[model samples]
Target: MTDGVTAAHGTGGHGEPADAPVSAWVLGADSGGSGLRITLAAVPEGGAPQTVGTVTSTEPVRTGAQGIDAEHMLAQLVPAARELLERAGERAQAAGLRSVCVGAAGMATLGGQLRAELPAALTREFSVRRIALAADAVTAYAGALGQLPGAVVAGGTGLIAMGTDLRNWRRADGWGHLLGDCGSGAWIGQAGLQAAMRAYDGREGGSAALRERAEAVFGAPLSGLPAQLYPRTDRPAVLASFAPEVAACADRDTAASEILRAAAQEIATAAAAVCPAEEGVSVAVTGGLFRIGEPLLAPLREQLHRRAPHAHLTEPAGDPLDGALLIAARLSSDALRLPQDPALLSLT
Candidate 1:
């Protein structure tokens, strides 16, 4: 048995020798605004793969003129991969990496460089043959529903909804904070802040509760907020940090409650837009934005019922990292069923 590799069904048991050779290794990675996570798993001869090691980095990959900086991602990923391989012992490393699946937040629109370079780069680094570079939304769908006919709304600082019927992918409202992502945490926070500003100006449609919360969070004389907020590169995440304040004030503030309700409507509408019309298709809402809890979820449930009544609301089975691993496993076993796309789920 390898030092770090866990024995799977066909190795060291079930009539197989303890020294049974590993067939291959697969790598799964999820990269997003927050950071990057990589998982290494080993597949034994005629056995399912088991996770051997994992690594995470808090620094997100940088974006440059060409889009997501492939070099930057590789800089973080290669070392981590090497560390995992070394930990897995000689036998597991000898099998080598056979396939890789990387799910990145901007892979659909901002992954030109990744698509153009990642496959060849990975090939050089690990001799990888099969690779799936996917948009985070697609991975979120796979994570939530596992290739089943369903809709998945992933809402964090930004939001996107995706659905598939095993034929093609449908997407909605991932246009970032400036254009869409209507039901996202940033949206809610921006709305809450607007209400707070309105109250400061003695205007209509203002919430005193939100105003107090905002002032408490951002400091007094809220007019100074722009100076504090506008210069940062991570404006979306900063804005989203206020979403919980809105949720916290929902019980006692009419404006806050209304903001959440409207946000829910937008999210449900996005979900419905991508959801298969067939009855019983699963719908899942995933990500940190949903953690605002019943204040947001209760309204979201009601809105989903109204908008996607034929769809069954389901809890997410896993997250994007799990989805990437699932895709890698399927690719390794030659059982991948998700439809291929140029931008959303590119295969090589």
Candidate 2:
């Protein structure tokens, strides 16, 4: 019951007459720790789809005992979808949203509610006939390689590596800050802070530079950092905030340099663990962690060279949002081929 219906008039919004045909539309969404992004695209008959409009929400969807809050997500998603539909003009509303794909962070583990409820909700709102709910990692792979055989490493506040041989998915890490997500932003920041603490304790592996940076960033009496950090809900993001300082000190501090090297090794190892064994398989690294530049990427490149020599490293083609769109477009056309899993990707 979202408004803006124009199908009865039949105008295509391109100066076409009331009898002109309108292209079908699809919706794609990416929801993660940062926020949610929704995109609308037009899929013309026998032609490639093109993005028509997009909307973003800075507030991340909430999670609860049942898992990712389905109703909470809908509260944000419905308004965003409607906004896009309106912005794309009356033709888009008339053609209608036929399919939707959502790629969310934690979908593999916390998507039970989303899987159970989202399809029905979208069907009611947009009359969508098909839906694909996927783990953000899977979408990251699609965005990076576009259905090609490859491995994709997504590193942000957390990290995960995903790959496929066009048959099944293989994943490594992404266990969260406390358990795994090794070499992720949180990992790097935690390592840096540990080095800082070691320096404060006059330990053998201590780095005075890291200690200084930590104290400067976290305030004097670094002992107080624990109280400031541990009680928060956004601990991973809070921890990740210090990663840039670690990279900044890498050139002058042996401990920082070693931390980056170790992190790089861990990231490369994860990528190797999931990378398809076929010769010349592609591997791409995506996310904000790499933005720290040479302090991280240089060592990562070296580690990748050593651990995954047969797999060539490449730049990502797009991002998780783009991956969701690709999935939506393919699902609408009945051409989706990515392996499906109840947890990672469920098609309806």
Instruction: Give the runs in model 1 whose Cα sits over 4 Å from its true position.
Output: 1-24, 43-49
Question: Which consecutive 10 residues in model 1 have the weakest lDDT in total?
Answer: 1-10
Q: Write the per-residue lDDT of candidate 1 for residues 52-106, one digit (tens) a residue.
A: 7778887888988889999899888888888888888897688788899999988
RMSD of 1: 4.4
Prediction 2 global C-alpha lDDT: 0.86
Candidate 2 local Cα displacement, residue 20, angstroms: 15
Q: In model 2, which range of ten residues has the least summed lDDT?
A: 5-14
